[model samples]
Target: MGAFRGLAAWVVVVGVVFLVQGWLSDGALVFGDDDGLVEYESVETSELMMDAEFGHFLDRKLLQVTGSDRSNTTIRKLVVRGDRRDPTNGFKKYRDGYDVKSSHYWASVVYTGVYGFAIGVAWLLLGALITLLACFRCCCCRRKMPYAPRNRAYFWIPRILAFLLSLFAIGVIITMFIRNRQLHTQAFNIRDSIATSANDATGAVRNVTTTLTTVETLVTKYNIQGLNSGIIGSTVASLNNQSDTITNKVNTNIRTLNRLINGIEIALIVMLSITLFLVAMGMLAALMGWRTVYFLIILLGWLITALTWLLFGLFFAVNNVTTDTCQAFTEYLQAPANTTLDELLPCVDLATAASASNVVKQGVNNIVLQANNALTQIEQVSASLGRPTTLPPVCDPIGAAPDFNFTTCPNGTVLIGGVPQVVAPYVCPSNPVTTACLAQGRFVNSTQEATIKDLSIAGNDLVAIIPTVNALTNCSFVYDTFSKIVNERCPPARKALRNLWISLLLLSIALTLLTVSWIFANHRNKKPHLIHDQEYSPTGTTARVK
Candidate 1:
């Protein structure tokens, strides 16, 4: 009976020891889940989750950051509102509910331009009336008229003044020409800068998509067992669609802006050239005492002058709006949230930004985890078969969750950048005897080595893209572009517009004065001479006493 009890106790002790050993071994196999391996279903689900999260990031965060969502709003629409709210005011109260095209809006933002247009119209009407009266008198009236003596200083005075006025008009036009050229050049520079920025935005997005595609291809080409490349491909297509939408909208707006700017530049060139030619011709006609030519010049000059004033008004308004936009843009950059610029460049909310950033970090970490876990499992299998893994594990590019620092890696891990160097030494040369080579030189078999190399390469690519992704999510890239525009571009553009406006105003005034001088000079030249209370012949052939 003592021997039976002793045997039973021994059996129970052996069985318990075996079970505990099995449990420990199984626990060693379990890294985070029940199975130590990354399953296809889990990977697919992870991909889908990442796709959904990233899609939301692209829609809400990236769209706002890139300014593509508000591409339809022109500069005019951005600035000329009835209730032009101060951008410094909080966004919650002033983000919406304003009339963009109200008469009150136009008058408030561009009242100086409105007045200029009104005055230009009045000048046009007055010039037309004067031109018609002069034409009628010259062609129909045969009545005798008094003439100033040829030797009179006053007669020469008008001629001399007309000459000086012509010279002054020429100076004004030259200044206008210089300002216009500067403005044109500056505008082109700004356009190119904006184009480059748009390209950068799209390129960043493309890089993400392309890298993902490359990863998917690698997974399939290498027949990596754990990942579902199909899921990645589908996600890539969805990302492409979203990126295309943004790219198209931005391109459309850029094209429209290009057309508008080109048209305005052409008009400016034509108008300035015509005005300069007319001024010169009018001066020559007055000097030569050509009544017909002088009359023609006067008519054309009036029309040109009126048009010039109208353009002055238009550019005056443009200058005002430009100044306003600069101020608002500066304010917007300082505090992006709760401003009028939200209508033009909406910012992503904090929660969405945080969530997107988390998703990115988590996605990247999962990819690293998946690769490393697979490598570990392979190492275990090799150990079971009496072959040891020589290759080092793939390093996590990011730290653990909650604070995924790029600079920090988990224990016994190398950074993705340094993995290539660490892995280079373990790759086996061509050899038929895999076990002998692995044992002798601590080299992994060629196939396993290739998998390690591919994973390392993929990790490097992923790490390279992380900064770009972070920039897009946080809007730092877009903010940098805006900063460039405001700090470097806005001052020169605003100055050019202001200078152009002043030059236009001066030219208009100078042309108006020159027209008056020419009219006076022409009247003086055509006046008939009368002697001693006698009427001069209608034909100016002889004077007869009346």
Candidate 2:
């Protein structure tokens, strides 16, 4: 009986001390914060828009300023500010959802500590009461058995406390499970949005290529003389009207596409909000649950399971969030296809590699060809508007056979003909040989000037390409920077998580010790005869028995 009391005292004191130590030393409470969950948009859409707007201003107004190089500064700053609406909004763009800041972490830790202390005290009190029952049974009760009323009443109190403790452990498990599921679901939705954004980005690039190709072909057809007949003229006019219509359509679609991408960015913010809420709720549930359980072994198992679930949730959450972030940044970064980086980056193959691939290639080719044909009709109209009577040279080819010349005119009023008569001399588009690479079959020296002129015209049509490349470069830089931040912060975040686990582990140990002490105390009280057996020492008559 005395042994049981001694064991109970040790359990009460030791469990209380360990619980207090864990509470005080717990880094989980002090270090855990939701800054990790705050979603960082690797691509700032507003910033990109501002850059694009400023570029537009530079091309249209600032660069044209008479004798004022510094004019760029004023217009550049104005365009940027106009596009941003509120420059401070750029900073606010980062996800600032419900955050578990440093203070929250400390608050959680303090709350848990208080609960742990209460639990420890309750367990110690239970132990002491059990030990008292055991002592009374072995000594005073053996001589004069206590009334059934008193014995029953004493047993009831510990039984109620044990039941309450079990309920608390179960509650913690349930709460943790709920939080885990919520976080997981939120992450999944964000992943879906990422996929959608990626698809939109791909589609936008295809549209750009289609538009550029169509414009190029139409520009070429404008100079083809034979195509300038009356029917062709009307067709060209109709096509010009259609071209204007398509241009508007393209612009509208591009804006719509931008809006779609931005919507996904907002979803990223929502994802962070969900993450923070789940984590905070989890913390609350965990602390509350741990306090409810009285037994050390049961509490320990429950806490371990809860911690495991939390880590598993984080594992998936981190991956989903990281991937979504990457895709989101890439979608905006890769928006422009003609920027330096864009030209350097691998583009989707336009050619077919196999029979199956040919099917898709052929479909896309047909679409591009139709789009170009529409532009050709429009260019013919513009050409006719410039000169109506003398059909553009290619449309008015004179002789049927080779070596035809206008010098053979019978009246001798000869307008002069042949290759030299009709062909316009080629002029190099620019001094740099790099930009004016000769087209196929055209030697560097062969009609170099004429070829260069043609190349310059084609290049001018592709002027939008450069800015697109620059945008991509900026986007990539943003991606790399944010990725580094996430990676660097991950280590400390993981450590904080580990500390949380350790605190739970200690709580479990305390519960197990308390349970063991209670069991022993119960055994001693129920078996007072063992103490009496030792005291009797084989005497003919028991000390309190006949």
Candidate 3:
């Protein structure tokens, strides 16, 4: 029965400790729960839960897409809506191009490591120090007994807490390493894909340029310009120059994008290495004591958790935002009224081409003049030669009132035996009139010549677009393509990275708790002999007080 007294004392001491620990951790001691979510009004719950500082962080990170570091450019500014450059500051950047150059590896691991691991550990360490002071109260007091009175409650409290903390910390560390690796893979893949996309965009530009050149060559080969001075030499020249300009701009933007992505990849690798060092620091603190580790863990935990919350927010934002942006561009491009084709394509604009069109029209009319003069000259020769000369003005353009008498064929054509024959016809011309004449001599029908000349002049409309119109029409596809990239990469990375950071933070907390428990366990037994006034006590034996 005497042996039962020590066991009974231990049971009472442990019971009191269990109750106290439960009360402290549960926040059920008539005190409010800080982390427990509640309700709010007149605002979204997300905003209420997320502080303004967190929103600021989100704003900065999002600014990377719009590149609105200071709102240098956007549609809102161009449109002059109120006094803002961009109502959302997300209206498109990079010379008003829609290109998403980002890497999750850069976004996730660096933030998690610096803010979550290093800073979080440091912050918690401070808190743990205060806890340390409480536990060390007896140590600091001036009680000069040979041995100090032991508090058994401290023993079990820290011991239990430490075991739990160490266990949790281990899981968190493993998760963080794995998460970091995943983000690295995601970043690498995205970088490669972006590189490929840039190459493709260059190809698109080249094809557009090639097509425009083809149209110019076709018109030139058929002598369309020679037929009429009003066709204007500057029109074709402008298209040729514009092609070069758009191509250079596209290539430059692509290079910039690739450079940015590559930089992120390199930075992520370096930051990951640093994260490993931080994990090692947390591990070391864990081994020391709960107070030391928690001091590092708690504060860092809050910071990391906050960042993760913001990441989760961004994960969703990327999905909807990217999709919506693509759709908006689609609508804008498809509708001529909203933004004309010329405004949309840096290559050319048809609405502004009225002057050029009129010039081409005049050139075609001049062909009619040449045709009439050639026919009148032919009839005169036929009458003089006494051939049956009744061919009315051949290929006379309808409603063309000829003001001049028969004259020379200054437009690379001349009268040969009363027939209007091309003196210098289109070289390798594919027009039926020129082709037939080349095959069967210059005695072809007037109608055929008229058709060929009209076709050559009509080629002007095709020149304005050449390779660009089709490519611009296909810009609608870019939105969907980017959406696919965002869906496959950004969202999942955001969540996984957040989880990874959170786990590491929890692990730090557990390590700190374990260390504190170790210290308390040691302190609990420090004065055991003093309590019983015994030089020695048998193993698993507690001598009862008299």
Candidate 4:
């Protein structure tokens, strides 16, 4: 009982000190640990309309979450008074819907703290006064009298307090059990998502590197490299050698992405380990009566639950109060399927990968187009190159078999028996017949077509691929995706998280009630009875209650 009283006293003192410190300090917000949540950007309402990608993203977010049709600047757009609109109703964008007002957080803190602190002080003062009275009585009289027993009323108070304490502990344990499962689910989702992304990156890199090797072959085989016909052919040949450089750049960036994804995978694994450890600690704390461990568990519950509540509470508040702006951040929550961190990451990656990848996609597409054009040029050059219609000098016999002789005048004719006669034409025919050599046009075109086909595949698709990749791997994604996960899986459960602080408060109240009831019992049972089996040790006036 004395141990319990000392423990209770310490709890009251510590709680009061912290509450007083928080109240005294000019802290702008009690709940917000990171100011990034409340921060917003002031965009001209018209700018949203002009930037088609941002405009669409903004529109989809609003329509999906709130089903709001008021996207075209009718809602609370501010002007310069330096910002002339009503401050209370001014419009702002979260870019992601993951913020809360500082006012709400501080209000909750003060509301819960002030009342609890005052009640605690009252109990402390009363207990101190009672102790002083007992001490003085002992000093003045120099005699101690056995204290009396209590009535049924004193016995029942502790029984009721114990029942209430049991309930608070049960609620906390149940909440924690649910939360542990959720963390495990989230960790697995994160791991799987990272793996999926890693695979596509791998495929894209291998395909690009392997396929671009063909471009060098095309250059060499077409004689584009060796053609000494003109400067143009030499330039064309030089162009084909650069495939290696482009391949290197593509592979480098892809490998960087792969490393990042691997790091994410390892982090998720670590998070899973930490989550399991925390759950085990929670169980041990709940089961064991060690006050230190119990307090540690309480503090973990306090921070995690309080901060989560603050974040989501403010996020929801912003969504509710502001014009439809950033619902895409939470749209996944409203989706039909069970939302996972896996899915949200890809959604975020979609924007980034698409943006970065479009550059790649366009580059690859240009390669395909260029290759196709090269194939056309090869056919044209092959067709245009034909044998000239002229003969190399051919010296054949002028005399023919069986008395047939042929001769032609280069400028004169030979005559027989004084008769002028024209014989066969001059024996040497100079004009040439057509040559039959056709360049390997068909084979080169086939090779070019194959190269174009290789460059066509960019990678796996993303959800929001139509938008800019500005949000990929950014810190804002942590908040937004986290917000989405909470909104989707644990909206109902989050109330428990938010109210966990209150649960601790109620538990403290229950403990205080039990402690006060114990004190009352001690007051009445100051000298508890002792019984002996054989004989009451009454030979001396021990003054012990029977």
RMSD of each: 28.0, 21.4, 14.9, 21.0
Best by lDDT: 1
lDDT of 2 by residue, 150-251 (tens): 354454444444443433333333333343344344434433443333343344334334434543454344433222234233333433343344344435
In candidate 1, how many clashes are counted? 1
Over 48-150, each residue of candidate 3 has an lDDT whose tens digit, in order, gives 2322421211101111223455265433211101111121334221123222332322232123223234444554566567667766875786343344334
Q: Assess each prediction's global lDDT (C-alpha) against the native.
A: 0.61, 0.34, 0.40, 0.35
Please tell me which predicted candidate would have the highest TM-score against the true structure: 1
How far out, in Å, is residue 107 in model 2?
A: 26
**Candidate 4 lDDT tens digits, 1-546:** 999985675565445534533342223224323422232222322233222422222212223212254254322221101111121233222222212223432232233233344455565565557667867987886554432444655655544443344444434334434434544454444334334443444343334334323333333234332211342233323323332333344455446555754554454345334433443454443333234554444444433333333333432333222222123233433331222223223332333333333332333233333433543454455456541222121111123323212233233321121110111111112222112213322223333343333322211111122121223323233344444433343333333332333333433443444344333333443334444322224244444343
Query: In model 2, which regions exceed 4 Å deviation?
Result: 1-29, 32-157, 206-526, 529-546
Ranking by lDDT: 1, 3, 4, 2
What ordering of candidates by TM-score runs from best to worst? 1, 3, 4, 2
TM-score: model 2 vs. ground truth? 0.29
Model 3 scores what on Cα lDDT? 0.40
